[model samples]
Target: MTILLFGITKDIVGSPTLSVPTSSVTGKQVPKTVRELKQFLGDTYPELNKLSSLAVAVNHNYANDDDTINSYDEIALIPPVSGG
Candidate 1:
């Protein structure tokens, strides 16, 4: 599965996307829910935990912790926005 990145997230991740395995391979762990995904990402990319407010979107809609994530699902990380 690939997780799209936006704004600061992309900068921190050093790319526009994150590739997470759908099945455990080479000791990699797969996340099955928004919560798990966040935890996994936070562990992998500690910088993500520093965002003032981060949002998760699935299939173009905001997702809750309990929201399910499938191998083929679309996921993205959005950071806080500010306007002048």
Candidate 2:
């Protein structure tokens, strides 16, 4: 699967795009869901788990916990922002 990081998330991943492994589901390489993706990211980058909160976007649209993702889809990580 391909994950597109934004803002601070880009820094965390150290790049704009990330290639993640996928498991076979009915002979197709399906990407993990939003919840599973979170666990994957946390396992890959432990520091992100310490953040207050984060939002996820799939194909430029916001995603919920129950949303299922595919390897061909685009995913992005959005961290909380603060400015003054």
Candidate 3:
């Protein structure tokens, strides 16, 4: 699955998108839900844990923790914003 990164999240991840593993050589699973995705990202990029807020979106709609994420689903990560 690919995660669209925005704002600080993009900078933290070092790209505007992130590719998450849905399957492994051994046929293991990874991040089947939004919550698991977040944890996976946090483990991969500890800086994500420092953010005050992070929103997950699935197919342009806000996603809850329990929301399932398929390998072909569209996901986005929106981080907190600050303005003058």
- Position 20, candidate 2: lDDT: 82
lDDT of 3: 0.90
Number of the top TM-score candidate: 1
Error of 2 at 46 (Å): 0.2
The total of clashing pairs for model 2 equals 0
Location of the lowest summed lDDT over 10 successive residues in candidate 1: 21-30
Across 50-82, the per-residue lDDT of candidate 2 in tens digits comes to: 879889999989999679988788888888999
TM-score, structure 3 vs. true: 0.90
Candidates 1 and 3: which is better by TM-score?
1
Question: How high is the lDDT of residue 24 in model 2?
Answer: 61
Count of backbone clashes, every candidate in sequence: 0, 0, 0
Q: Candidate 1, clashing residue pairs?
A: none
User: Which of the predicted structures, 2 or 3, would earn the higher lDDT when compared with the native?
Assistant: 3
Ranking by TM-score: 1, 3, 2
Candidate 1 lDDT: 0.92
Index of the highest-lDDT prediction: 1
lDDT of 3 at 79: 94
Candidate 3 residue lDDT tens string, 1-84 = 888999999999899999887777535458889999999889889999999999999999999999998999999999998889
Q: What TM-score number comes out for model 2?
A: 0.82
